[model samples]
Target: MKNMKISRRKMLIRSACLTIGSLFIPISYATAVNGNRHLSKGLDLIHKVLSRPLDVSISHLNKCLSSGKIDLENHEGFKDYINSLITVFNGHHHGEDEILFPTFEEKIKGADFSKLKKQHKEIHPIAEKIKDKINVTDPSFDNYEEIRNLLQKMNDLWIEHRDEEEGIVELDMEPLISSKEQIELNDKLSKHGRDMSEPANLILPFLIYNLEGSDRDTFTDDMPWILKNFVVPIIWKSKWEKMKPFLLA
Candidate 1:
């Protein structure tokens, strides 16, 4: 994580003034700092921000919706979450298409960049439709079927696309790139996500809540000291109070 560009010290300094919201009431759910689940480890420098975070999001979303948890009480928070999820997913791909893929196309010999690009093209409309549906649909006993279907479709497409992409990245791409190069790529991609997160409150909570076990450790460990240590416990609930009801962690 040496080259993760947003150094902990820098982030701490940048984020210091944002603690005004820290005084609000904290959430009741116990912190997941000592997480229960195990993370599939690769290189945390990349996968922590890219692969596993998205994977956690997809799985949690599927589980929450499929387990019959969607309801009127959570309708607003859930909608907020869907938007945040899409923002992160869309931003990641934007970074890839704009920054990462071009690098891979130039660097990795015979890389089938088109296949991934094609899948992205297919997934975009589905995600866009999901957002539209989520925004309009109020959950009732029978009204949410289409939203569920769209979410499932979105999750499935993402699963298929990301699995294929991760294999290529870890096997074909990792060997060709230097550690420094990987960090540079990770930083740019992370910046893109940071730039895209709206309502900012939801982004950090989304990231922390989605991660678990050693994966959580790696993310928190790498976070600027102020964010993971102070913001999460003291500031998170106040900032994300609206979405807390529907959040997984």
Candidate 2:
């Protein structure tokens, strides 16, 4: 149950990062920020990387809910995916809260991050409710319906908060920070996220399973050399193989 709650929070943050990645700050705003290509490219890559998994997860949940039956095999598979999603999601936000937000706050004057902080606090209970449902060992279609409702509610709140945060960063914050600083911050946050999500076995594979073609290549390129060449291939292969079916299907 504790793990499930943590996973739920992680999923929420993962979705939020995807939202941030997809945001389109104005061309004028980009120009005004001294044209930080790193920040722009980094956000776009992050979106591309995370978007597929999010879409796959939501689609799978919807299918399970609408199918009117829940096979134990499928239920267990979904639980594993949820756990992986939780890890990545939590890692992303942990990076933001600990690395990005504090750093950004210092650079940008009179910026009030309390609201965003409050939103994170508020979101956890909603995520916990959905997680509780997902963690049920014998979930039925009825259980799926309950979970679906909870997820819908979570999505609404999360989307609003995520969009607002992105808007703040793009419109208000980026202008104040230098391009080099933004790039360094992005790197630190990315590293922090990967470190926090370690064991790399489940999280790396789950992320890869959802991505394809160019998006997969971009994600792989962004990975640390050892993780891309060795850790994923040599260390996590077995775990990934077991979980791949659920995520891909």
Candidate 3:
């Protein structure tokens, strides 16, 4: 009976996770920090702007590279395309490492900001190496195999870096981000629309899921602006409409 109960609970939990994940907008959990909520929204907005298009473009380029069906000269057209995505990605990480992370570390001492910063240092060189490899070079160095290897390395490094930043290091913002600070940050972030929105949507969901009873209520109630204006419409509802098929698949 105990085993059956555990199995049933696991199934129910999986169902809940799927339901929540499919909805698009992140639900408010207790322990949701207003400032972190704001930051999450900003991050999600920025990520959507950077990732989706880059993934599509890279997929096409990778396929062409594999088949030898596309000319390297044609890859030149995608230079700007690739660069645009890289610029936004770098800018987002730069803001986190330089602006957001420092502020939080200063406010809440004893947190392992150094470790996160170190990850940034390690990940950036890999990113730069990929960028260098992708740039059109001399014919003597030409080899599709080398390019393929670079792409694999770049992709692997990127996935690992994201997991570390988003997972390994738990950013305890409860002590740092006061309600007042969140409002101030929101006011400042109003300038960048799409760039800000991508990151917000991406992180907010994860943040919401992590929060518990009271913290969750406080975070959501205090930041109704997110639900009414941003989260509900621009993110969750929009995602539900668009991403439902993918989720079901």
Candidate 4:
């Protein structure tokens, strides 16, 4: 009887320890068995995917502006590059507004996305102004300073918006949503973005151009084998190369 009681007590203690230990597991790691750890992991992939292109675009513009003279021959190239950046930026936020945030709110009760939505609306005009400036401005050094100043303002606003949005998603929403659900939501968001944006021919190349080394590898690894093997090599490679001159080194 005494031995049986001791054994029972040990079993209870072991069970209690496991119950407590489970609570201490990081939210992200807690879903390891679900095979959605990639989704639960930090938002680094999303951040890099969205922000790297913006950073490259802004850096290229700044480098050109620093010289105080726009290269007339490459002026149209620069405009195209800026337009591509704007397209990706707008497409990403549109996906967040229409798909990602809505899904997040559904999972997290009492979630307030009004302020974030307002920020999106506020930045639209600034983005449109930059797009308009790129389209209408002459390819001369004459309006270089004006365009440079406008781009600088747009960059500042965009960075602020990006940081805030990331904080909301990573810090606030990540803990609330399960890893499996996040993976599913991420897929939905991506699909919605692809459906809403320009054709993959244009967007994919720009995304590829901005990513390098491990980021590039991870992105390509996630793509369908046919896209990575065929479409990227046959279609997007040249497009990326053509835009290379307007992008940062």
How many clashes (backbone atoms < 3 Å, residues ≥3 apart in a chain or on different chains) does model 3 have? 26
In candidate 1, what residue range of length 10 has the lowest lDDT sum? 23-32
Arranged by TM-score with the best first, the candidates are: 4, 1, 2, 3
Cα shift from native, residue 28, model 3 (Å): 22
What is the TM-score (0 to 1) of candidate 4?
0.74
**Candidate 1 TM-score to native:** 0.71
Superposition error at 83 for model 1 (Å):
1.4
Per-model TM-score, in order, reads 0.71, 0.71, 0.51, 0.74
User: What ordering of candidates by lDDT runs from best to worst?
Assistant: 4, 2, 1, 3
The TM-score leader among the candidates is: 4
Off by over 4 Å in 1: 1-70, 140-143, 245-248
Q: 1 or 2: which has the higher lDDT?
A: 2
lDDT of 1: 0.59
Q: Model 4, 1-249: lDDT tens per residue?
A: 999999999778545533332222111111122244444342455456556655665676667677876666666656767777778667767877887678778878988898878888877777777787778556555455655666677667767876776677767777777766776776665555565445344456666556677656655554556565555556345544556674432
lDDT of each: 0.59, 0.60, 0.47, 0.61
Instruction: For candidate 1, write residues 1-249 as lDDT tens digits.
Output: 875656886567446524432221111111122222111122332334434434543564565557776556666766777776676667657767887789878887787689989998998898788677778655543336666666667767777886787777766776777665665665565555555555556666765665577756655554567666666656656655656654546
RMSD to true structure for each model, in Å: 10.2, 10.7, 15.1, 18.7
